[model samples]
Target: MSRALLIIDVQNDFTEGGALGVDGGAAVAAGVSRLLEAHPDAYDLVVASRDWHDADNDNGGHFAGEQAPDFVATWPEHCVAGTPGAEYHSDLATDAIDIHVQKGQGQPAYSIFEGTTPDGETLSQVLADRGITDIDVVGLATDYCVRASALDAIEHGQHVRVLTDLVAGVADESSASALAELAHAGADVVDSSVVAA
Candidate 1:
C-alpha cells in the first residue's frame, strides 16, 4: 500500500505560548520529526495542514472578539494568513513534505480536507491524485482538527492510522475520548513506532 503522512495543524499558533496552545505541542513536533527521520522510506508522501485564516473574516472575528463563548473564542488572534503564527512549527521537518494544504481560509475548517485549493481542488483529491491509499495522521488538538481530519480521511475511503505518540490534544479529557471515538470509527490507533513497522 502507498502510505502518506498527514501532519495536521502544527502551526506556531497551536504550539506553546500561542493563541490556542495545546499541552505538549512542541513535543508532538519533535516526535513527528524523529519519526520521519527513523522511517524515511516507510511513507512515500508527506502532507502538512495549516490553519490559514483571514484576519477580517467571521471565523477570525469570532475568535478575536468575545462574541462566541467557546474554548476557541478565548484564543488570541492567531494564524492569520501569511503571518508567523500561520507558519509551520520550527521543529517540524518541512523538507519531507510533498504537499502543503491550507485550511480555514474564509470559513472555520476544522477538517484539513474541508478546505479547497484556489483551483478548487479538495484535500482528498490531492491525495487521490498521488495514488495514496493509506494515511497516517499526527498533529495538534486531537479532539478537534486532528479528529476531524482523521474522520474525513476515512470517509474518503482511505485507511486511516493515527500516530498517538506524535500527537497532542488540547489538555482535556475530551481528547482521550476523541481518540477512542476515532478507533471505534475504524481508524487504526497506533504509535509512530508501530507505523514504522
Candidate 2:
C-alpha cells in the first residue's frame, strides 16, 4: 500500500501558547515524530502544511475585521508569513518532511489540496505522481484543518486514515463531532499506534 503521511498545521500559532493555541498540540507533534521514528517506511511521502496567511489583509475574510471573530469562518490574526508563529512547532520533526505546503496565503484554504509546493506542484499532483493511494493524516486542531484534509483526501479518491491520538483540537465537543463526521464520510479514525503496527 502506498501511503502518504499528511501533517497538517503543526505550527507555532496552533500549539499550546500561540495565537490560536489548541490543547495537546505539543503532544501530537511529539507523537507524530515518534511514529515516524518507529516506522520510517510506513509512508511513501511525508507532507506538512501550515497556515501561512498574508500579514497585510484579512486573507479573503479568513480573519475577522469589523466585528469579533465568530471562530468558525473567521479567525483572529494568526500565522502571518515570515513570523515565528508561522513556523512549525519546535517538537515536530519537520526535517523528515518530504514536501512542505503553505496555505491561506491570500485566501481561506482549509484543505492541503489548495496548497502548492515550492516547485509549484499541487498536492493532488504530488500524490498522483508519487502513486500514493492511501493517506494517514495527523496534526493540530482535529476539528478544523485535520478534518478538512482527511475529508478532502477521501474526496480525491484516496483511502484516508486519521491518527486520532496524534491530533489536537479547538474544543472537545466540536472535535468529537468532527471525528464522527470524518468516520461517516469514509475515513478510518484510528489511533497513531496503528501506524506503528
Per-candidate TM vs. native? Answer: 0.92, 0.98
Q: What is the lDDT of candidate 2?
A: 0.92
Model 2 error, position 80 (Å): 0.4
lDDT of 2 by residue, 1-197 (tens): 69999999999999988999999998988988899988988989999999999989999999997779999999999999999999999988888999999889899998898888889888999999999999999997899999998999999999999988998999999999999999999999999778767
Off by over 4 Å in 2: none
* Cα lDDT for residue 65, candidate 1: 65
Predictions in order: lDDT: 0.85, 0.92
Query: What TM-score, to 2 decimals, does candidate 1 have?
Result: 0.92
What lDDT score goes with residue 26 in model 2?
Answer: 88
